[model samples]
Target: MATPLIEICVEGIDGFLAAQEAGADRVELCASLVEGGLTPSLATVRAAVKAARIPVHVIVRPRGGDFLYSEAEFATMLEDIRILRGEGVAGVVIGCLTPDGLIDEARTKALVQAARPMAVTCHRAFDMTADAGEALEALVRAGVDRVLTSGQRDTALEGLAILKRIADQAAGRITVMGCGALDADSIRTVRDAAGLRELHFAALRTVPSGMAFRNPHVGMGGTGKDREYELTLTDTEAVRATIAAAKS
Candidate 1:
């Protein structure tokens, strides 16, 4: 069987390059993976686009925490989108919701319009919506090209049922990209259950920090601690496994 295409999420320039080299179909570029993924800087966005052989989709989140955006944050998001579009990005990944956790159709539609000529992906904010079914319809109506969801659960494995439902409801009007905690072991089950064509994961592992010095003053437990950055590097083995499973 042929391998299914994989879209990997990258945190920085190195990760973007690695994903392309490791056979990713595309990359979602963002900054501060620890914060879940806030919008990347203009320089980083441009660099990723220039460095990547494949398409690069920049995340347009102003800040992390919630999908709800303040007036200033919303304005920032729009500005970021314009900047990235000008930089020749393939698409933009963003999501906005009302305070009540419902898709903000008006705001989302406006963003979609501003992102002309480039695809728009409604991010995991769909998982936070009050009604996944209603939100799916709203996103489709808003002209969103795709949605990144974990089935409204914390991870794809846990949310397979809901993810499958959303995929069925989407009915080809839009794509339902399964994401979150997707690895070689579970990729096959997710693909089988969701019946989705696209899947997302960070083929990255945490590496130990080389720094030996300990900041005792900053310790919550008053003891020296070890910390590591969540860096993105394509794990060829993991990617190969996921692709194989999808094809099966």
Candidate 2:
């Protein structure tokens, strides 16, 4: 079998370098992984582009939680793409949807047009669309080079069947990438069952906070069970393991 394209989702300079060193075909640079990824700072994008031999694709999300964007938020995303393109990134990841849970074709087309020369991967927001079939068609028409999805489910394993269908339907018109809760088993499943050549995952592992003193009463972000103290970063070991498993 041909080697699969492993795209590692990373948040900073360290993660980017780790992914390249570990043999990732590309790196999807984002921030706020807890919120399902937001746009990283321009500094991070610049550094990642300079430091990596593999391709670096920046996420164009203004915020997390929803794929729908306000006019201003959409504008910000376009500008971010422009800057990344100038910075010599391999591509940009983007998604835009309407209020009715369909691909916002016009807006998406504009974004893709503005992002000329830089490949665009419609992000997991494809899963949130009302109809996966319709959404896939719209993305194709909008000139998206790839679509990253969990097959319209929370994780790729659960949605392997739909993922397979998408790959067959796309027929190489656009790349279908299986992602979400990915690991060796899930990646192997996509290769065999879904027949996709691209895989995406974070490979995140947590380490204890650097803080010597703790204030149990105060939370820096989130709340209750959703607080941050540990640092969740991508591990190079996990990346190497994933590539080995995919090839196996």
- Most lDDT-accurate candidate: 2
Q: Residues 162-221, candidate 2: write the lDDT tens digits.
A: 898998999989999889788876689777888889989999888887777777777766
lDDT of each candidate versus the true structure: 0.84, 0.89
Reference-based lDDT, residue 101, model 2: 98
Q: What TM-score does structure 2 among the candidates reach? A: 0.96
- Model 1's alpha-carbon lDDT is 0.84
Model 2 residue 18 lDDT score = 83
Candidate 2: give the clashing pairs: none
Model 1 off-target regions past 4 Å? 1-3, 212-225, 228-236
Which lDDT tens digits does candidate 1 get at residues 8-38? 8878887787777767898999887867788
| TM-scores for all predictions | 0.90, 0.96
Every candidate's CA RMSD? 2.8, 1.3
